[model samples]
Target chain A: MIILNQSKLNPSNIQPSEITSREVFENRRHFLKAAGFGLAAGSALLLSRQSQAAIAPVTFKANSRQKISGFSKTAYGAGEKLTQYEDVTTYNNYYEFGTGKSDPAIQATLFKPRPWTISIEGQVKKAKTISIEDLLKLAPLEERIYRMRCVEAWSMVIPWVGLPLASLVKWAEPTGNAKYVEFISESDPQSMPGVRSPILDWPYTEGLRMDEATNPLTLLAVGLYGEYLPNQNGAPVRLVTPWKYGFKGGKAIVKIRFVDKMPLTTWYKAGPSEYGFYANVNPNVDHPRWTQSSEKPIGAGLFGGRIKTKMFNGYSEQVAHMYTGMDLNRNF
Target chain B: MKKQHIVFVKAAIWLFALLPLSRLIWLGVNDNLGANPIEFIEHSTGTWALVFLLITLSMTPIRLLTGQVWQIQLRRVLGLFMFFYACLHIITYVWLDFVFMWDELLIDVAKHPRILVGFAAFLLAIPLAATSNSYMIKRLKTNWKKLHQTVYLIAILAVVHFWMLVKKDLTEPIYYAVMLIVLLGIRVYFKYQPHLKSKVTKAM
Candidate 1:
């Protein structure tokens, strides 16, 4: 099967010998150049762990929760580690790190997440800055394999390791006016290079409705692929709302502000027509640019047929009551 | 019009045109086009068609600017090829994107801004390609000139369609815009200056 993928990618024999010697054969040269690149890329995956480390040694382990019980190992590099698919993770949105997936791994590798602190400010009664270590110290960990749907029309099944967001919020103690929980990553043009691109303002911001944050479905993940988080996967800590689009989960978080009204989200700040604050993974409500009814799974590549996106990304049983009266089409 | 010369020219241009189209087809076949493969293919083919269309549009201006009168002969061939790629572009979207699902297709046409501009450009090209013959020239001798005026509108939409498609890094769009401005500018100069038009036409 592996050899089959390589067999068709032969670029050396792309043009006949006659064509290469033609007076106008710019394309033959271009094909020769492209074929070289394709072969190098195809070989990179077969390298041993130690060999791959020479390039970028980010050792990975399985989600710690997989060690616990009946949760069968998953496809999200579970019970294993992850390698960079510069094309996939880098280009798509895994919003916990910011909307751009590639931007986070590239920009976030510089963010010093270790020995980091998260400040719980705004309407929270016990507002204080706490070390991430102390925050992790407060809760017991579990692994949950959740369906992640991006608003951009892609989905992934990831086994995330973290505790409920409720556990952290309860520790913070929300006050009466706190209707929204605004999760903000530290803004550093020096670190988060995406902010430097003028795509969105520095320090990504995502908001969850007060009840939504309290819901058991929301998780504060610190690990994926069964080990410490990769920088590209929003290392250290980030939200994991399995049912909502990936953007709803903020990454490399530094500020947790409890607010009264609905907080403005990053995509909404840039273009409200596409992303709604409540970015539920719904099939009926299409993005202004594309359909939300279907999504491509990672590694499925282009020719792979799309899977039908579910209501709330198939987590409706756990979260559907949150929007009992509101029209999903409108809220979406 | 030697048989062998015509055959070799056709083969060369045919091979030249196939490269870009083949990359897309290869990617589509290999499942590497990206998440929204249908959209990616649609946008890609559409963009290439616009590029080839713009390249076809540029021929006259380039000839005018460079004093290369012989460059004019390639215009009809390039124009016809533009339509060929444009057909594949739209067909790929209709077949793969909408999957020929009529109701869903209508909704997509209504919702997607990118699809609208591309669809409009495609509709305009049909007439342009159909009229590129001696029979149509003889039949609509007077109206043919007026009906073919739609290429100007198609060219502008072609550029706008590309500009709107880009999320950032305006370089590609700007490059197309420069070509478009030159193409349209030469037409405008020749159009208004009737005496200069004959001189410009004869010189080229």
Candidate 2:
């Protein structure tokens, strides 16, 4: 519920009184000190609050994020506690800007997400480019809180504001031959520094099967936290397949191609053995580098231990039928 | 170097080595550890461990190049500091990251080669750190030198652990690998120099 304006909370605004005493600030040192005095009770709550206050200044900058209006709330993730707006905006994995988690927030200041156009190509009724302004008007926007899980074993619960991707798919009127949908993100070397490096293929790409693309749970998010999507959070629009890993959400999309053949996604091409095409959040199938059985929830204080990862990231009731017979272990 | 000068230099190295830990505390107090504080701490401690390990490896080469015995004298403290940071890095992973979830931790170590390699490197460093003091060094004598030579393997495993963890962009890991290669390469070249010299003299 806290609305933080990143620009307003400059580091210079820090007052000496706001900071906890040094002995109490360092949790381990404080714990030792408290244990020495036999007053170890109630320290955990105090430390968690202090840590929360530490990152309290990290929300979207007022000048950058425009308030989105007239979106209806949905029953999605109704009972879940929403991740702090500051954490959602500040912690990101937009590689176009940079690879580091905090890189996107700092490096995406110059990225212009407005006046954007998405070129719909291949197997559609007619290939056409639509402006972001036109795309925003296609359907009634709804705010859906969804749990977004990253393949790196971290997750955040975000209230995304946008229409279901199925609306766009229906509007596009794909031909019978269209069996897959591919999303290609913008990659301007001038604006996106990470594009210059050969980390993954330029113009980051992701795709979903025809059925998955049309699923109700799949969203085309234009904004989050009741504001226009921050430039770092893909800006104008991006895909949100809650059942899959966060990488499946292609940001700053410039192209959407409906193709007969399965498209090779960026992560899949980068490391075929590790990243798979489906990328469904399955706890049993572990990533080659790390375990997928558990994920650390972001905004959970330093002491907040990891939670057990769920099948389909806990959206199996809606999405499990799509992959009923598919061997996820081999596909993963 | 005078005995007092050596003592002063050791104190300075210890202070410099503690700076990374001090920096982490400063950042923690300021709430400047970024969005993922645990990750920041893990990376900081892990990177410092590798840096100290590389510095420890460089001592023999420095002595070889500059013929300075003082460089060798600094190696133990530098090596111990590497072990110290390595301990903190592993503790962060086990205590903070997993919170003593032994089942998950065991499965991760078993399933992921990256975690296993890093764990192995820490295990090897244990004895080296244990026998670093004067009493153990005198008691073990020649065997101590043989046992400590495993540092070469530990260094290699540490670099490989880093190399495997990165998804793409091997630039950082490659830099560490190159440093390890150069440091270890110096020893190999020097070890064979006498043999090579004899062969050249016979041919002449």
Candidate 3:
């Protein structure tokens, strides 16, 4: 065990420049106490302009209405490297644009995500359709560092900017009967090529239990890495339930419905056996096709070592009570 | 065919087969291998394995139709390349993916049907690759022909492995499946049409 720890400490295994740089090294030391050394280095590396440019998100003409705010940051998944913006955008699982990881970035380049409208309806006391500008003005946006784990056994630490879904839910004034919230992404096949194929049922749908939707941790993210959200990263606005797998956070959302019962989700509807409705990040509950026991951190590059996946993506303390008295294995 | 042409074709096949590997090396060295490099390597090697298998599978039909007996001899080299890539794909998983965790790897293999099928395909290819040499071919004689036929099954298993791994958007895997079906279909059609085969052989 001592030898193993010593070997891991050796910087040769990782990039020499990262270990040798004074700023990165100092940041690692200061942040390592709070966050894992790897996660600290990963976040610090993301701030470097070179990596930022390399993983550049989709560029939209900056909208004046989108106000950017910096907050006292708290690290989630400390020691985990933030997935490069390039990979996060380019290596997307946005089936609406296409299936290939790189497809959405390319296909979504021409997609107009601005001037969007989202309708708040269903069991809510107030039903209103609002423009993207109106939605942006609804609340103050703050950055939350989250560990976004994909169902495919790959994970990333993303610094997301958005307001809590709870704030939006309260504004909508959900009725007492409201038990679930369903979100629908833009479904134009004329622009989104992947929607042309039956790979998934079109008009991608995702839902959250009302409590899960309104949890303090549930975010309706509008930006990432201090910039407006990239189109492929679900521009304008999208849900970010950090404890669940990334898919549960529906992208390019156009509709928000508060319902009395569970809603049909795209992946769950397509392959019920492979994708569960909850889609919580449970390491013990393996997908039918792959194991969830471990995940390859994005931006760790090809040769980087794997890390054991944490329960609820290491957010169990904040969200575990929600699943009390329930069996994840059966529900999963 | 002229000796020059045979040498040129051999060299071209070698170059074409090594292109994917060379590109991978370049990407790895340059740090251009995106977010999940292991996945990039695994997918690249796995794609090349299918490519080589498809090329090797196409060779028999090409030889039967064109009567290019020289191309028939190249099948062994192509088959070996396929086996080499399959080995790389498995190595990437065992070494890089699971990092020699025998227990985890074992459990994964048992649980994931795609991994099991992929492993079976690799295992089946080993004997055929091992016996690709002239000595084994000469020693085994008719048995060699029977054993070598396992390539068809291996190819099918390989495609199935890809098909299962992809959740939806079967476009990529379906392409391989169609190509393999057509290649296999040609053989079955030619076998039943012995008279037409003789005419084609005469023309060649």
Point out the higher-scoring one by lDDT: 1 or 3. 3
User: Could you tell me every candidate's TM-score relative to the true structure?
Assistant: 0.75, 0.87, 0.86
**Candidate number 3, chain A TM-score:** 0.78
At residue B144, give the lDDT of candidate 1.
89
Listed per candidate, the RMSD to the true structure in angstroms reads 9.1, 11.3, 12.5
The total number of steric clashes, by the backbone 3 Å criterion, in model 3 comes to: 6
Tell me the tens digit of each residue's lDDT in model 3 across B49-168. Answer: 988899899988987777766777688888889988899999999988878878778978999999999999999999998899999999999999999999899999999999999878
The alpha-carbon lDDT assigned to residue B160 of candidate 2 equals 94
Per-candidate count of clashing residue pairs (backbone under 3 Å) = 6, 0, 6
Give each prediction's DockQ, rounded to 2 decimals: 0.21, 0.25, 0.20
Q: Candidate 3's residue-wise lDDT over A1-332, tens digit each?
A: 11111122321112212223445545545775588777867776554533322232333335622446653344544565677766676677888877767557656756778789999999978798878877777777677889889999988889888888898888889899999999999988877877888888879999999889988999998888877887778887899998999999999999999999899999999989989899999989888878898888888765676789999999899999999999898887
Clashing pairs in 3: A38-A79, A39-A79, A39-A80, A55-A86, A302-B37, A302-B38
- Pairs that collide, model 1: A62-A226, A63-A226, A90-A102, A96-A251, A302-B31, A303-B31
Report the CAPRI category for model 1.
incorrect
Per-residue accuracy of model 2 over A115-211 as CA lDDT, tens digit each? 8999999999999998998888899999999999999999999999999889888888899999999999999999887899888898899999999
When 1 and 3 are scored with TM-score, the better candidate is 3
Candidate 3: regions farther than 4 A off: A1-80, B200-204
What is the C-alpha local distance difference test score of candidate 2? 0.85
Q: What's candidate 1's DockQ score?
A: 0.21
The superposed Cα distance between candidate 1 and the true structure at residue B21, in angstroms, equals 2.6
